[model samples]
Target: MNMSEWLVRTARRVPDAPALLSGENVAASYSEFAANAARIGGLLRTRHKVEPGDRVAIFMKNSTAYLELLYGVWFAGAVAVPINAKLHPREAAFIVEDSGSKVLFVSGAEELHSLLASTCTVHDIEAEPTFAAEGAAIAAPEPRAPDDLAWLFYTSGTTGKPKGVMLTNANLHAMTYAYFVDVDDVLAEDAAVYAAPLSHGAGLYNFMHVLRGSRHVVPLSGGFDAVELSALVPRLGNVTMFAAPTMISRWLTTARETGYSGEGLRTIVYGGGPMYQADIEAAVAHFGPRFVQIYGQGECPMTITSLSRSDIIDRAHPRWRERLASVGPAQSCVSVRVVDADGAEQPPSEIGEIVVSGAPVMKGYWNNPDATAQSIKDGWLWTGDIGTLDEDGYLTLRDRSKDVIISGGTNIYPREVEEALLMHPAVSEVSVIGRPNAQWGEEVVAVIVASTDRPPNPEELDAHCRSLIAGFKRPRAYFFETALPKNNYGKVLKTELRKNVSGL
Candidate 1:
């Protein structure tokens, strides 16, 4: 069945139930949402001439209208391409052009409309009329095939230009099923608060509220605001939410200052980057055992590995606690393996690149056969992330293959070095990158953010690293900065770091 049918089913089953609530405004119920989606779908078809499989870009912040547009595009038998609102016009236009989106939706942002108007048809979402009067005129399209493209997500291209990953209706349905299996306890009564950008996979997957007929709440300002989140916990009682590691760090600080207990919160799913054990422990303590750790990518839509509440609760044993550091066991629908460069599977405890085979994996990169060929081989999506699987079947992510630092033929994972630096009392955040060296080929370099009023010297930090990790893995150079640059999802932009420190 087509994934868009979920909205129709939910609307028919629970027409009066709350479908979407954006801040103080409520979209009423599933029937209302479906009607609005149909109306918008009709408008796109009749006025905008949105054809089947045509790419319609949503370049707006998180809102009730954004969700409507997503379903509307799919209902109209077109593909929805949600671009990052934080991206500059040039970057947004690149995505629009790359996806070949014929029409773009813009809400509350005039600059974005101005940017896309030059390349494609631009529509202001606020100006659109409600479906209440357009019922008789609006016509629903024919059923969509499971293999029809539902969405196009752009991944950060190692080369200069980003590539769009084409996800089919079947891919999304598979992802929703796998996600529900991983977190079966989340039900219709639960509400999910979206703290991440709606453009990213984490945000889009988390917003799959149709499966369980749950309520979706987007922040008022359409950005992560700690103060607003603290208030939202009480307003939307017993809600589940997801955030990036950096957002969690900020929330931890805010929760401490405001004495926010997150008492009504059922689950706090975190992914996009590795959260430090200390941070996870702190979050678990404050929010109870509802901290679920998920590890996946845009290609997979977040169903690879999951660490549930039980895993975090069983942290008494040092070994068990160490398992919390892992990304956890593979989910129900996915088959994960660690393979060498030659695509040979590695034995237990041996580090190699992590590869996954699953229904949720994207069909391929849109219009890029070379990249599609490089990523998907023999039906397995090569993640490019290096990891190891224990005899117990738990998978531990070591580092990304490109991020690995090879110094004098010894492979050094930056996560190991960064973890040691995080243990330092003076260190608040840290990132490790490899630098070119004349003798060792590539030398390790550590960049750190010291605690307020406590600056750490390079020799002292280097000594700490040496004490914790092997000498060869220790960073030879150290740079102290007030803050480290990170992407929208809280992942440290290592590419930016490499460019910044290439001279060093």
Candidate 2:
């Protein structure tokens, strides 16, 4: 089924229901949203000559217009390539050129014209006469096979240059279904805030909310600002949003200081990075049981293992702490396994590479057959993350295989040490890596961002680690920095850190 059909079906059921919001103002009702999308789709076909399977890119910040163009691309049976608005001009152009997007829908980011110069035709979505032109009635929803491409998601490119992940209509449908059963329960009155980058997970979640005929709200700030989010949440009742862990930490600190109780927040689905156990525990204490964590990659747009809201608040359970540390069990509609080097499944509690096979898995890396082959073997996508599945089926992520620290032939997962250090009051953000050592092959090095202006003593940090984890796992050395280098999505750029260490 064409994924756009969800909007059509929901509009027919609740024509007058609110569908889009700008802060508290109603941007469009379900019927109006559908009509706008159809009109935009008509413009894409008649004006831009966009055909089935053609690629159309949108390089704009979070706004109602961005969402309209996205659904319109899908409605027109073309693939939507939503580039991160914060990406370097060169980086953004790479995605546009790589995806072969014929027309780029831009919204006043004058930077984009110079960025995508001579690459693709740029259409100012706001100024497009066809976008505002009326009398373009709702046309028949384009027919697309389940396997046809729906979205071309570009990876954040920490490891190398970005690769386009080809998410199919079937993959998105599965994600929408998973959100309902495994993520959260959404009602027609429930609204979702697009506080994170709409180009990434936050935008992908539009499917889940729209499928339920819920409202899609873009904050006045256009992006996340804890103060703005704090004020907006209470005004928009029963609101849910997808945020990165860093964004949540900021909200937690802001709430505590300003005494903002986060009223009317239904759920915050956090992913993109590990939410330290200490951080999540504090969040639960302040927010009161309203966070869901999902662990997935670009290859699988956000349907892998999910740590539900129930798992966050059930602290009285004997295994609650252990479960909280885990990313949770395999989400509904996917088969997760921990496989050894030879592609054999590992026994319970044995750490191995996590692999997933499901409908939500991508078709392949766009135009990169070698990468596609390396990632997907048979039907499973070999996620580079190493993890273990307990007897009860909970998966505890050890670390990304590339980030493992090997000291004296012993493998030490960086997450283990990072979590231990995060427990220290002085430590705020830490990234543990292996530095080259002649004798041990690699020595554990902890790069930290202290909570205060005064850097925490290295000995004190090491002493704290000794109390929480094994002695061998303690950092042999520590480096203090004002902040850790991170990508636009807030994931630490460990590759850049490695380069810094190499120079040292």
Candidate 3:
């Protein structure tokens, strides 16, 4: 059955059950959510003329309307493209244009509307009613074929342009099924709080919590608020939440300061990047051993390698704890291997590229055959992440092959900024690396070796970058040195650069 129909079934099963709660407003009852979705779907077709298979982009922060729009798009047999609201106007425009999205929905954000207006038809959600007049029950749009594209998720490209990862209906279903295997008991009575951006895989996958008949709650400001989370955690009983390492760190700090306790937290899943040992320990101490760690990519949504609560409690030895440093074992229906350049699997403890083969892997990159060929070879996805599989089959990530910088759960490619920086006449060499930040899991730091005797200040360099790239990609810190470290082959050793910046 099509995933959209699942909601209709759910509404029938539990009509009065709360499906979504956005701050003070609670969209209580699945019937309410289904009717709202159907109305929005009717509006898109009758008022906006949105056609089946057409791309509809949602450029908004996390909210109830955002969730409804996703279902509305699916109900209309259109593909939903959720863009990062934190992205710059140009960056946002690039995605809208790249996907050839026919209609853009903005959350009353003038900046987003103006940006997308140049490319596609823009619809403002705040100006429009949540639903239109009740129309005849439009037969749920035809069930999408397994291979039909459901979502177009853009990931950082090594070549300086973002590549849209085309996820099929089957891909999402496989992920949902895999998630259920890991957490078997997620039910309609539970509630999930969403703070992560729905644009990323982590945030979007958490929506499965809602699909299971749980209520979804968003923060008041539509972004991460530690102070707000501390209060909200108790308010929403038996709620599960997903957070990045940085977010968990902040919540832990806030909890300690105010003697906060997770009275209602059942599961706290953390992903997007590594959680430091200290942070993990602190989290376990405060929240008890109720944390779950997931590791995967957008291409293979939720093909999780999870560190369960049991594993966290049994911190056996320093070596065993080091295994905790790894991304954990593959989920059911997934096979993982560490392979060398020749695609030959490496033995345990040897670092190589992590390759995965499974039903959860994406069909291909949208409209990009060359990229698809490069990433997927013979049904296996070359993750482009350097990692090692342990004797027990757990995978430990070393580094990303592409210059993709993940900072605060957002992916940023260095080439995108480097190309922009090259425009400056005074710049000679530039390398952007993710430096450990207490708040942001990683913060962008650019190391530049200037050609001109008078070096540009960090603000000047930042301003130049800001003009070309998204705000998130702009460097948070700058360092000027004589030259970048390179090997005999003249290849810049990013390892050395990272070490220097890390002060190792």
Candidate 4:
């Protein structure tokens, strides 16, 4: 099935139902949104000469127009390349050039104007989305094979240069299925807010909600703000939004201060980064049963293990805390495994790289055969995440494959130590990294952001770790910083952190 068909089919079913919103106001109905998409698609085909399989990029922030452009691109039988609005022009230009996109839909971002003059044609989104009614009318969404490219997701380039991950129509179909089966029981009345970047996981979920004829809401702030989100809870009832773990933590703090119980929130599907056990438990205590945790990568999008709300509140089980600490069992469609260096499966309680094989997996990296070969082998995506699966099939992630610390022949996962440090009352956010040491080979180091007015000193933090984790895993040195460097996705940049402590 063509992904764009979801919008067209649902519009036919519920023509007058609200389909898109900007803040508290209704932006478009199902019928109107479909008509606009058809008009834009018609323009792309007849006027712009966009052919099937061509890449059409959208370089705009989260708004009503962005969503329409995404659907219109697919409707026109072209692949959508959604660029991060936060990226520099040079970075965005690289993706436009690499994808060979002939046209770009952009807002009035001064940085992106240079790219319009260089490689691709540009369309300003601030103007009314009106197209001449003259093209061969689009009767229906153009047909394409299941494996044809639907989205070209460029990684955040934390480890290296960003590579375009080719997500297909079939991959998105599997993702939508996993959403209904494992994520939540979404309803037609449920609404999804786009506070997170639409270019990333937040935008990918547009189809899943659109499939149910739910509302796609873009916050008025055009970005995430805890204060604004709390106000919108009751205004937009039964709301669900995908967020990073850091955003969840910040929102919880704001909720407490404002006495907002998240009265209308249905679920907050958090995944982009690790949600520390201490932080999650606190969030659940405050927000009630409204959290679902997922673990996925760019290669697979958001179809991975999921920890449901029932599992979060299920305290009667003997291993409830352990299960809560895990990213949960694999989803219905994907097969997950933990394998050693030679692709051999690891036994329970042993750490190995997490690999996935399923329909949701991407085709390959675009125009990069070497990266494609390294990431996908035998139809399995090597996720570069180190984790273990328990007897109950629960998956516990230790750290990224590149983030492990080897100290005196004993390997230590940073997440283990970071979790311990987070238990401290004074610690707000913490990132653990390994620094080269001649004596122990690589020493564990903790870089912290203090939560309390009176920050805990190194001596106090050292004793705190000794009481919780193994002494060898305790930080050899502690550095107090106002904040840790992070990417747009809220993951702590351990690579930059490592560079900061390189001379140590």
Please tell me which predicted candidate would have the highest TM-score against the true structure.
3
Candidate 3, superposed: residue stretches over 4 Å from native: 112-119, 129-137, 316-319
* Model 2: pairs clashing at backbone N, Cα or C within 3 Å: none
Distance from true position, residue 33, model 2, in Å? 0.8
How high a TM-score does candidate 4 get? 0.81
Q: Residue by residue across 1-504, what tens digits does model 3's lDDT show?
A: 455777888888888888878764686578887877777777778766778778898888788788878887888878889888887778888899989998888876677565554447787767865444543345565467877777888876889888889988888888888887764358766777888887775456644765777887877877788888788878888777778888889888988998887777888888887688888887888889778888888899867477766776676655677666877888886888899999999999999999999988988998999999999999899998998888888788888888677787777888888888878888999887878777887878888999899999988988888877777889888888999999999988888888988752
Rank ordering of all candidates by lDDT, starting from the highest: 4, 2, 3, 1
Please give the distance, in angstroms, between residue 67's alpha carbon in candidate 3 and its true position after superposition: 0.3
List ranges where model 1 is wrong by over 4 Å. Answer: 108-119, 126-141, 206-208, 316-318, 403-504
Give the TM-scores of the predictions, in the order they appear: 0.79, 0.80, 0.95, 0.81
lDDT (C-alpha, whole model) for all candidates:
0.77, 0.84, 0.80, 0.85
Tens digit per residue, CA lDDT, model 2, 1-504: 777899999999999999898988998999988888888788778867889999999888899888878888888899999987765455677788889998898777676577665557788866763553553644867999999999999873334366899999999999989998999988888899999888989999998788889999999889888898888889888999998776787788889999987698999998876667988898989888899999988798788999989988887889999999999999998999999998999999998999999989999999989989989999999998899999888999887765766554344668767877988988899998888764345678889999988888988887887765557778888998898999999999998888888546
Q: Name the better of 3 and 4 by TM-score.
A: 3
Winning model by lDDT? 4
Per-residue lDDT for 408 in model 3?
79
What is the Cα-based TM-score of model 1? 0.79
As for candidate 1, its clashing pairs are none
Clashing pairs in 3: none
